[model samples]
Target: MNTNLSNDNEFENDAESRIETEVSSEVESTPEESGAEENLIEENISTSETAVSPTSAEITTPIEDNEAAGEVKEVKTASAATSNNQGMSAMAKGLAVIAVILAIGAGLVFWKMKVGTHGESLNRVTAEDMQIILKDANPMQLKALAESPEQKKKISENIAQLLAVASQARKDGLADEPIVKQELENIRAVVTASIYDQEINKDKGPMPQFGYISEDQVKEFWNDTSHEAEFQKFIDSKLTLARESGKFPKDKELTEEELKQAKDDFAKIMIYAEEAKEKGRDLGEDFNREVELQVKLQQAQFLAGRYAQKVLADKVKVTDEDVAKYIAEHPEYDTKEKKAKAEQILSRAKAGEDFAKLANEFSQDPGNKSPSGELQGGIYKDVPKGQMMPAFEQAALALESGQIADNLVETPYGYHIIKLEKKGEGKDANGQPTQTYDVRHILITTTVKDPTNPMGREIPVTESVKAKLAEEKQKQVLDEIVANNPVEVAEDFTVPQPSQEDLQQMQQQMQQQMPSRMQPPPAGDIEPPNSQEPKKPQPRQ
Candidate 1:
């Protein structure tokens, strides 16, 4: 947080200090308003919903919208779970630096600058001036800071960064804003005070929570062992960001000489970082109480989360009996019966009639009518689960390539007099199993929604209600799981809200991140790229 220091062993080298900024940016907690926490949560929400999947390999299994082809891509893109108030809270109001864990990143270190107490020829910020700047430089505090000659000399060299922050704020259209100027002054003041506090008092109160986060309980739900691909993907993202941001050299890879220098810097950082961490853990009675509260709260949330998954996922079943019982209990569960009126078509196909020819002549799939009097049969090629209704999928799966069902398979859409053209087993690039079913079916549309009916429509048969029944039962099961697990927080703990100006500045900083937001924050947890409508759609497949 304290950006400037001179003649210090920990960050004596300018380049080392600049590199340290990357680690500093890795705070575990920021107030609810922080951009860093928001981004992290966005990336990790899928970690929860797919309790079966790791946060790393969030697979896409989209349910196609029959209304429009475009909606299929939209649903797949937005499949990640929402995480506004999940796992742990993000509010990390701190006296200084919001909240940073000693663990910066993989192989990175924390630099502890021993200042004020050391008797060396170096610049510093006076204790008095720091307080004045932080607390809006009151008349009395300003008068006292000016009168202290020794204190003034200590701060002469390091105060420029504070001035620069002010200058940057003005250039960004915040100069005329009195509240914005004061908030900037306050953040700088806190940073300066924290430095002096560390220098003068090694009594850092109590031992704070370990590494700012405990991953043990989270591991209970996310036990997937396949992460080698994820690790490489993570490394690739870092490398790409470096090139895109110009944070590292513009070349694709570091030069030999550059790599050597970086290695040496990394070595020095590791040594000093360990020392800083050791000192912080044993820094007397001034332990970070906020961190302790956050750790405890997170532990409790993880416990509840694990329990919910066990009950909802591990215990719940989707057997045929479950659906039957649900329908019996709630008459509304059985959607209008839709029977594929394909007795004549099935008989013709079984009587040595060409199945493809029969499908082209009799299939009633919507939007498949041809102007030339030729039937354009709608075909499902290399179909996966959830792309088609459960009954249709199961019936097709039971048949081998080139096999046709003797009886009609009923689904909510109607019925499928089906034929399996092909079946293949394969793995995607990420090494997950991919079952491809090239299925040919002539759908007979036998049901339509009607406002006149009590259940909002009328269907012809009970066998056709599989899809809607399955979806409703799944929701009911999840609702039951949440109802069973009671997650409670410490009643006494409360997070303070930010003021108008503070919230505005936080919002501004978030917008400045890559793909700068062109519009306001979304009502939902997910933030779309740049604007409500993305500039361009990048295909995930």
Candidate 2:
């Protein structure tokens, strides 16, 4: 029964089952329950997308606020239980795995592919040419612009803002302004250098599950010429399997002709490879490195994920007692800053004010507000540790239902004031830590230094001040564009703001359908793999 995959698949589905059983909707929930968990994905990755900016007509017209926030994810039930159970011996499973491996002997045939060289070269740019680049360019260049992890989160938004700035320049007839001209030119340079430039990066960077390779990997590998044959082999294998598998549930089996055509489309990229070098606009070599890498990265990521699953997933151990013992031993987990913040929040809660009212009025967390601008009504239920920031999870585990934190909890996202609504191992059967929490919180984000120009040049501003100024100016420009072209959002594009509970449920469901992802350790704290220090425990994937 494909025993090699049995443990891997089950380890993947555990979270799915738990969230499936207990995720109640926060369609009526509180932001305090956000617990810094909302920022988890944001803390690690930036995706690359090739956005076709709004046409001039789209620019002048009232832009659609197509961002929607009403999604409710449906869950996937695990297939019927397999013969293998928790009691199976390690040796028995190993032997079964070996048997399966031997039965599926490999025959990898690599064929050399000739790359195509047919696209227009992006050598020189005129004013009009620059304008097109600005309008059509996406946030790919934003990757280089991100110097810090926090800045990376803002890159996409900044790209949108930059696009707005460019559009306003056109409307104001300031094409020749040095600032306008330079910004557009810089954007063009960034765009022309990118490999595959068409997808919008909404998946928070990597394909979840595999956690191995990503679009960024595609870019890095694109410049290397050695992977061409290897990549083609990968494509042939995947397409061959797809052709045989009949493409899953809907079963739109690939026709013979369709398979041939698909193969041809892939072949053309290789045949046309040299064309990329023609334009010589400094976009670099003519190899279809991006295409080749894209093909390879998917498989590479999956392989890595598989290896980790086989070797590491079983090492994770979580139980109610384990969590309680964890809390008892990790006193240093709390910082002086966090302790003070928790004390202040506790004082406010003890002053006899309604807790929910305080969460609505004073909490700055986005989770507090729903898609419809209504405050999410109740407590967040059955939040697994995997769904929460590690610090938040630790702090929550230290409390029980109706129990409030005596000290503050800090995570990369912010300070959290937690009140555990419910706590038990059985709350979520699918989560890594096994236990879950029904919790509420008040989030206090660290403040950024404000822009202050003390004296003129004699008493200069700090680098922080300079950065803040740039931010303020950028915002002013975006505000102008919004004023000129008010947003008229598409109904489908409205961003859904599910409650913390709903978010956890949906995330659990989504992860089940995806390749188990590897979320990087939060910024700065991530150590190199060879470090002698203990490794941070990752959320079981």
Candidate 3:
């Protein structure tokens, strides 16, 4: 039996050895399968080693794998949540900024449109103010305002009335009329032009070089001129009656001082009168014929003055009784006549004797020579009341007829050596007596040179120089303005042109309004309207 058991054991050992050999051969033949099997074995080994227990090992392997997978999924979800939150926050901020900008922009646009649309309604004006504003407006601007037919009709009706009222206002001394003001300006321009010519032109008179000239030349010129001689003769004739009546000194050659005064007075009158004449002539030329109208206007003025004088003539008569009555009424005009009388030492004055010395040497009055020499004239006539200084009037009043003032009288004009002549009376329009007197005058004068034309030659400026300078300056200013400013013109533009359709319509309308013959023929027709017939369209070739 022992022998039989030994044999069975040997057979089992042999079977186990054969099984091992078979497994080794299979691994060598299939390498990929071997590697996969080995990896599975390693995982199983690791799982087994980390297992808390045999059952735990089996459960933890799959549980741990599932936990790792769940953790990765949770991380991805958190990251996505954070990214979405950040995107939403940025969107909210963007929306807020857009809202604020839109609000401001909308408000500005609304305000601008409101102001622009209501500009005229916010500022109202009245009729008087409108008239004043429109008076000086250009024709185009006025036409724009009165665009409608009704407004234009109202303007036309009021314009004539307004002009008439404006004229009346001017006559009453108001100076607001544009037309009147323009006329006055034109007159002034003419006067200025005349003055320029007189000053610059050498042929008009004795051209002044510098300072003043004495009256000797003036007297000589006057005596040589026939017109002036005639005027002098007329003046002398008027004065002859006064001399014969012992009312004035005898006729004699005027002294150098007297001649000088007369020349100065004449020069002033001539200058002003010539200026007036020139201005009048300019106006006349712009209106009626030049010289004739100006002369007629002067004659009209003279006639008007004569008429006024005649109307007031009865009021200005004088008589001896009236003079006596005046003297009785005013004690100042009546005083004891001075017995002192002496010849004037005029020769001594001209012979280099001091004026004061000669005045004192002539011993006609008790007054000092200083005051006497300073006095300008011996008598005053045709002077308004209260014109003389109080002291001067008092001194003069104290003197009697034919009596000189004891002391020279100082007045605003100058110093005066007064002699009380005969007192007289005049009558007004009512024939009531008034104070009057006949007086005569002697004058001396001096002349002064014009500085603008020292050489007394005319300086002529040509039109070319004025035009060139004006054009250059204008171009310079225009270039500067254009350089500093930028302007844009619209892309699509065209000069206005009449359309063929418009011309045809206009012609048709004209034909409809007129008889066939009265209507205008075709544009190029040279034949008379009565001789022409309407041409028919020719057939196309």
Candidate 4:
């Protein structure tokens, strides 16, 4: 019983020991497990820290039920960034479009303004404005006005003023004055007559076959006539006057000195004459033909003048008052005393008397001879102021009314003693006339030398060589004329005898003057069928 009891106690103690050992083992296992858990917790904390360091700590936290909200926030941020970028791009594009549109619009506006403004300014100008602009404008200014829009406005304003003045003058009835009417008529007549003469000359074909007036005929007439002798007589009388006036050399009795001077003068005259002849000769057949045409023209002019006088006689009316008015206006016209008397004076002056003394002695002027020198008469009413050379006009103007000027009035023609028998009112304070002379002069001119040919080719005869040859030829022509001279009685000269061909031409011309209906067709041509009752034969000459 005691052993059994002791074994139970040992078993109890072993069991307690085993339980304790097991508990200890369990505690150790718990420690190991706890250690393992600590290690794991430490590792997890380190990993979490590392992750938090690399990423956000908030990301490591578990998202709540508001994860969708976070996602929405993120989405909103992305959207905002995208919208901002898109907005910038859209703004950039909008600005570019606006800039292009504004630029194009500005260009269009500028172009329209420029075109419209220039067009309006141009339309405002008138023809008269244009004329004035053209008239007074300098070339550079005109170019600017033409090209630049700004300048054209100023040019148009200047021209309007001139037209106004011209219009006023016409409205004053100045255009209908008798003098104005006469002047207009004269201008019209001149223009019309020129046209008529041109037409008539055109109608007349080139001159007849004789190469202008038969040179043979001209030479014959010149030689047969006593005109040259008469002309020489007149020249001798002029020379005598010159001698008496002491214009010639003083050794009057044909002394050796006088003879020598005379010979020298004659030689000079002969030289001039020879030169004139040469010039006339060098004017070839064309010139001769022109001369014939001139003769015909002169004849035509005379006939036309007569016809014009008859046709226009009613238009020209003269009154005594008109004549008096004319004389009053033209003081140089014949004075009452001059018209009343025909007394002439020839003062006997000493040979070689001073020109002033001669003038004083012979002057018929009513004014004192102290300031007056040479005096004469026969000045026409239509004499011009400066037409007489400066010297003559100065002398004439210097004298008082009816006063003779000092010294002989030398001119291209000869010396003259100016007489102031009449006093007249002058247009100016100085006795100058207001009227401008419109005189028509017909010049019968002779040149000493022939002009150089247009082609620069040498003439058949040089100027120096022509004179002698021309004189010889003229003499030969004269001789031929004398041989062939023919005389016509007054009856025979009454009418010109036309040649057969000329008569035929005249008949044709008369026929042409008739209506076209009067003309007959050519003999070879057949008449149109049923055109006329009978075919007419060609008209006989």
Candidate 5:
């Protein structure tokens, strides 16, 4: 019986030892054996976000299973709360930034509406005030004009009238006209564009005194298809303004090649303007001022022109009878008497008369005289074809040596009694033979001087003269309007005159720049870098 009890105890001890060994093996398994099981546990934990807690059945160690599971859950909850707080903080920062931007915008609007009143008032347009509107206006030019009190007053009066007319036009709803609106827009765009180009090139070393657009930029702009519509609008506006000024033919149209050349010539200005807008360069102070000046100038001019055409046409119309009356008052403007005088001289020259004697006695052409204003026998040496007027050049070219033109040749300046002294040939700078002629002629002066000029000296009757004549009548009308409106010029807003030393320095600088100005510009296949072809329209006076 004792031996049987011993056998049973040994068997119990062996089974208990084997169970202990199996549990140890499961808990401390090799990485290679548990790799697949680890992957499944990781995926389950990520998807379900289930906190891993050891079940009572799995926990064989001395540690308390429920307490350990509770600790793990608390750690995860704290970490998640930290992440949520961070997200909320970031969202709050974004909202705060947006609110600040809105506040800044509101402040700007408020300042422009309230505080900007004095700056923009037209009732008192001062030189300092004009500086805001005409920022790019040459300081030297203003100083020069201000040197004369008369000039300063004239400027003030002109500006006042312009503002008054523009104001009236707005009230009349003329600003709403599509054509007028487009013209104002064109002026603003062009002036802004010009300012932008100048600013960018301000640091590029010495430039032309008047400034010039770059050729490479112009070429690039011509090829660009973008902004084509804007280009067309500008061209149209320029033409319309020109036509309104009565400076160009009513039926004028740009030729195909001319249009392309125009594009290249004006490309830098228009394209840079577009770029300035896109790049927000238009917000610059200089650009803004020039734009405002040009826009206001164009608007005023447009309104004034329309008013002159519609309202003052009959009141200011110069009749043939008026011209005759003017000629009677100023005998020097009598072209009919001058033409007869030219015919008489031409007959004598053709009637075996000594041409030089006739030219000395009868020629009134200032160019036909010496620097001392003495008649130089009206002899032009080696005259080129294009140097003379069409009728004068034609008559001279048709004549043989020592032969006089059969009839008096008429031109804007006067009637010419041309005597061909000799035909000649000359070599140009390129060493190419060029046709030239030497001629003796008596000129009968027919051009009328500006009635307003006290000197009444013989001067070219340019567009400026015509404008002055027109302005005389317009001024009468504007004076009445201004009397009613009553604008004021600021007393303290004075322009400083340069000292004599300053003037000398300016003259010396101009002299120094003469050589560079005379030098031929860099060559370009598209357009001359400085070409102002398809000439920009002049603003109305």
Candidate 6:
């Protein structure tokens, strides 16, 4: 197998090129040769159980834990999710980024084994073998990706690449580690059960051969006292982690129905796993290696998430007192005084003064100012209806072109003196008719600018302070982890840096590959005072 990791786009293009070349060549083959190839592919369909894709595993849903409260939730400050004051939680974003990094590292191993051409010739693994691997790796995508010889050849090569890394892991004694061994077993059980679920769920006839788990089975599992205790311990640990990571509410508790459902789920998993073992699937070296590679990747993600959560809770905790101190120190962020200043600015604007000039001189919104402190006159052109704060947009929309709002508009940020410079009709991105406007505003901000952030959004004083502290703590924690576990790559291990275009393409691929739950939330219309304008895709709700 050739060992080279190229950009994902390159990978796809190469595969397509190969498929086209193979299809053209096959057109000239004899009828006997074609029939044999078809039979080969069909025969390998049963071996799909050994398929694997290191980067394709979805995040496991966390079962509720019932442990007592920990110190992590004490002093209850704002969530780290809102640390950036952006709609998306910063902590969740960080976790997703870490997941991406871990996935990439796992991918690096497989990519190292990727041969530029069809790898079957080198390994003596035919196209049918590759088909089975691809089918099992992504059962949902099997028909579309594995029907053709060239497709199977390329996709199977990917699965084969992962085997090399898993083999290396076994040779290095990694597979023998206690934690790894346990995790591998758990993963195998879950995957085996999932495959069984798919098989039984197939619409074979009016009456299926395999029926759903009965209530008796669920009860039987729960009736075991030891099983109940084990489940409790497992759930408690999961709940504790969920609460600490802010993924669940502090008071989250399990209910009878939920417990019963969990038992039923586990019963199915265990039964299917046992069945698979009895059928000799567990003894397959290829299947074991595929699972080993997945386990390795999953373990890395779990450790990183746990370590980052601990660092945030233990070392970078932010309290309300910290925010209060920051608010008190920054007099410019005083709400009462800022409100008064906004009224003054409103009066000046209504008194026939140059609105842009007043905005340039008085608006506290840093987005309207240049790095050299040059005023931009607070002008926002081609603004969408739903893109500004409710009060700000309401006041702007109520006025006619060349008119200003009669009263100062108040929002969480502070006060806005809005002037409608232009109002017009336009088609939105979806080609639907929508209202677009150009507006100018002078803002008197109640919040302070984040000194450490380049975009300079008007985050609350407390959030700014917390963000700073958390950032410092994260840096410290990461530094210590690196120092303790030193690593140096071999001189022969070098990967060429991707170009900017490659990076953008890679980002798109990652976004597509990322689970829907982990993706960032949509942007809200109510943008902060100093942040960039919101996108104009919809009208104000």
Question: Which candidate's lDDT is highest?
Answer: 5
Top candidate, metric TM-score: 5
Model 5 agreement with the true structure over 121-156: per-residue lDDT tens digits: 144565665544323222334455555666555545
Compared with the true structure, what per-residue lDDT tens digits does model 1 show for residues 262-281? 33433332333334445655
Any runs in candidate 1 off by more than 4 Å, and if so which?
Answer: 1-289, 309-319, 329-337, 340-376, 380-405, 410-414, 419-440, 444-496, 499-541
lDDT of 2 by residue, 194-304 (tens): 232222222344332212234455455555666466444433433332222222212334455544433333332222233333534344332233333222221212221
The deviation in Å at residue 420 for candidate 6 is 17
TM-score of candidate 3 versus the correct structure, residues matched by position: 0.16
**Model 4 score (lDDT):** 0.26
lDDT sort, best first: 5, 6, 1, 2, 3, 4
How many clashes in candidate 1? 16
Off by over 4 Å in 6: 1-99, 102-226, 239-255, 274-282, 312-441, 444-476, 486-532, 535-541
lDDT of each: 0.34, 0.31, 0.27, 0.26, 0.44, 0.42
lDDT of 4 by residue, 1-541 (tens): 0000001001011111221122123233232222211111011111111211000011111101111111111001110111121212211221221111111111110000000000000112234323321322122223333455433432222112112211222334433444333322222222222222222244455532112224454454446457355333323433342232223333433335543433332222233233333554564553333323222222222211222122211222223344345446644432334322212221222233343444444433222111133232223233334433444445555665445444444321123344333334335325666532211111111111223223221111112122222223323432332234321111111111234554454455546657774667665424333221112212111
RMSD per candidate (Å) reads 20.5, 23.6, 62.7, 65.7, 39.4, 17.9
- Native-to-model Cα distance after best TM-score fit, residue 535 in candidate 6, in Å: 7.7
Candidate that beats the other on lDDT, 1 or 4, i.e. the better one: 1
TM-score of 5: 0.42
Residue 511 lDDT in candidate 5: 75
Show where candidate 3 strays beyond 4 Å: 1-228, 234-256, 263-295, 311-541
Instruction: Give the C-alpha miss distance for residue 323 in model 6, angstroms.
Output: 12
* lDDT, candidate 6, at 507: 60
lDDT of 5 at 513: 68
lDDT, candidate 3, residue 505? 46
Backbone clash total for model 4 is: 12
lDDT string for model 3 (287-335, tens) is: 2122222222212221211221222112222223444565466554322
Q: Look at candidate 1 and tell me the lDDT of residue 477.
A: 45
